[model samples]
Target: MRIKETIYKWIFTIFAFASLLFLVGIVVVLFKEGLPIFKHVKLVAFLFGKSWYPTYEPAEYGILPLIMGSVWVTVGAVLVSVPLGVGSALYLDELASYKQKAILKPIIEILASIPSIVFGFFGMVIVAPLIQRIFKLPVGLCALTASIILGVMAIPTICSLAEDALSYVPRSFREASFALGANRWQTLTKVVVPAAGSGVSTSIILGVSRIVGETMTVLMVSGGAAMIPVSFFQPVRPMTATIAAEMGEAAMGSAHYHALFAIGLILFLVTLVFNIIAELISRRFRIKLGLNR
Candidate 1:
């Protein structure tokens, strides 16, 4: 028993060390590639300048359009997914019958398990054409279309994580609310939901990370237009899509290639900040729940 326990501990420690090394490796590579953008382009020009015509003779490196497009698509996706995902989670956690949960949980998990490429294909074939036909637009591949696909993809993750969080709330808490004459809905909204707020927030943050990192789906549906999106119906190119579409063709060691890495660096930093914020919020929520004690 002691030998087996020692072996398991060593294996777990090695896995953790490997994960840390992988993350450090990514950070080092991104920084090395991203730092060169300041050589030919001013920091402000790269960060805030609106134009993104990298193919121009002078090779403009303005990343604002891509940044704006990424933000727009991610926000749109979250707007569509958050309420629905949270509501579905609440339903599954607090109200669903055992049989219903048995059916619904697997369905939600299956949705998440579906490959992202398959989702992209579905968006390209079905959602885009529908939008184009309904709106009489030139093409349905746009920020809105991408948002809808990303929203669908995020739903399963948010729902599953949020449901797990809600499930962790003690039954005594619900019983106390019920004993106080609160209805099931009131108990859920005021007590259980608040108790699980940290977990739900964590889910949202995770979903944000997933949305930001998504490359193929956004590339397929976002029309690959490297311009600032004035409206959801207009074509836009997210940072991930730009990287995916251009990385293959960008000449190695060129300014354009470095700029793409810079975009990735920005995305990674933003997601890291959100993750840190989520961790802080989660800790605070645990204290509120008296679980930190």
Candidate 2:
């Protein structure tokens, strides 16, 4: 038994260490390839410049438009997904019968399993035409379209994790609340949600992370316009889409190639910061809930 336990521990430890090493290797390579761009273009200009004409004479590489495009789509996705996802989670966890939950949970999981490319195709073929017809827009491929698609993709993740969090609230808390003559709505709103706040927040952050990092769906649906957008109806290209669309055509070891890597580095840092904030919030909530003990 001792020998088996030792072997298992060593195996798991090696696997965990390998995962960390792989992540470190990726970061190192990203910085190594990406840092070369700073030699040619000033960091401030590259980050905040308005133009992104990599093939034009003198070849501008401002990523502000890309940043804003990503932010707008992500914010739109969050606005659309959060309410629906949380509502679905609350219904499944609190209001639904066991049979309804059994049926719906698997369906939600199935939605998550659907590929991003499929969603992209659906948006392009089905949703785009509808939006164009209804809104009288020249094209349906815009930030709004991308947002709706990404929001749909993110919903399953947010709903599942949030439902799990709500389910984790101790039964004693509910029982005590009921004993004090609290209604189900009061118990749920005041007690259960607060208790599961950390996990719920984490789920929301992870959902946003998914939307921000998604590539193919945004690329296919976001109109691929590398311009600063003023409205959801306007076409825009996000950072991920820009990288995916241009990286193949960029010459190796050229300024354009280096610029793409730099964009990737920026994206990595942004994602890292988001995860860090989520962790901090989760930690605070855990401490407040007395779960850290």
Candidate 3:
């Protein structure tokens, strides 16, 4: 039994090390490929440049439009998902009957299992046309459409994570609140939610990261226009969408190729920051709750 345990430990350690190595390799490759854009385009200019005419001579490599588009779409997705997700989690944990939770949880889990391409197709076929009609826009495929789709996709993740967090709160806390003459709403708001705040925040951060990395759904519904979107109705392209849309057409080792990798590096760093922030906040919350011992 001791030998078997040692073998299992070795297997887990090897797998963890392998995963870390794989991530480091990808980051190294991305930075190496991306650093060249700074050779021709100044770092400030490359980041803040409004135009992205990479095909033209004296190739423009301004990534501001893409960055802005990514921000707008991600914010929209978060706006749509966070409230709905948190509300669902609250109901599941605080209000819903066991039978209701049983029905809804499976439905939400099923949503997570659906392929992204299918969501893309649904956005293209159903959402795009509706937006065009209502907004009278030139194209239905825009940041708003992509945001709506991504928001729906992020729901299951946020809801599940937040529910788990709420569940982790001690039952004694709830009973103490009740003993103090607190009503359900008061207990939930003053005790339960505060206790689970870190979990809720972590869920939101994870949802943002998931939407940031999404490619195909954004590409299929975002009109793939690499321009600064002044309005939600206008077409825009996010970094992930640009990489996916142009990867097949861009020549290997070309400037455009490097630019794409640069965008990828930016995304990687952004997600890493979010993850770190989430972990830090979670730890702080645990300490405040006296649960870190």
Candidate 4:
């Protein structure tokens, strides 16, 4: 038994170490390939410049438009998904019967399993035309369309995590709230949600992360225009879309190639920061709720 336990511990430790090493390796490679761009283009100009004409006569590599496009679509996705996802989670955790939950949970999971490319195609074929017809836009492929698709993709993740958080609240908390004459809505809003605030916040952050990092759906739906978006109806290209669309054409050792890697590095840092913030917020809330002993 001791020998078996020792072997198992070593195996798990090696696996965990390998995972960490892999992460570090990726960061090292990203920085190595990406930092070369800074030698040619100043970091400030590359990050803040408005133009992104990589093939034009001086090969501008500004990424501000890409950043803004990503931000616009991600914000739109968060606005659309958060309310619906959280509400669905609340219903599943508090209001739904066992049978309803049983049916709906699998359906939600299935939604997550659907390929992102399928969502992109659906946006192109179904949602895009509808938006064009309804809004009288010249084209439906824009930030709004991308947002709607990304929102749908983010829903299952948000719903599942938020439901799990809600479900983790102690039964005693609910009983006490009820004993104090609070109705279901009041108990849920005031007591249960507060108790699971950390997890709920984490869920939201993770959902945002999902929207921000998504590539294929945004690439197919976001119109592929490398311009600063002035409105939801305007076509825009996000960072992920730019990298995905242009990386193939860029020469392996060229400035454009390095610039793409730099964009990826920026994206990696953004997502990493978001996840770290989520962890910090979760920890802080857990401490406040006395759940972090």
Compute each candidate's TM-score over C-alphas.
0.92, 0.92, 0.92, 0.93
Model 3: runs farther than 4 Å from truth? 1-19, 288-293
Local accuracy by lDDT, each model: 0.91, 0.92, 0.90, 0.92
Residue 125, candidate 2: Cα error in Å is 0.3
Q: In candidate 2, how many Å is residue 271 off? A: 1.2
Colliding residue pairs in candidate 1: none
Judge candidate 2 at residue 246 and give its lDDT.
95
Error of 4 at 265 (Å): 0.4
- What is the Cα-based TM-score of model 4? 0.93
Ranking by lDDT: 4, 2, 1, 3
lDDT (Cα) of model 3? 0.90
Cα lDDT tens digits, model 1, 35-127, are 897898999999999999887998899999999999999999999889888989988987899999999998998888888898899999999
Instruction: State the lDDT at 115 in candidate 4.
Output: 87
Off-target runs (Cα >4 Å) in candidate 2 are: 1-19, 286-293
In model 1, the worst 10-residue window by lDDT is: 284-293
Estimate candidate 2's alpha-carbon lDDT, on a 0 to 1 scale: 0.92
> Which residue window of length 10 is worst by lDDT in model 3?
284-293
All models, RMSD in angstroms? 2.7, 2.5, 2.5, 2.3
In model 2, residue pairs whose N, Cα or C atoms come closer than 3 Å (at least 3 residues apart or on different chains), thus clashing, are: none
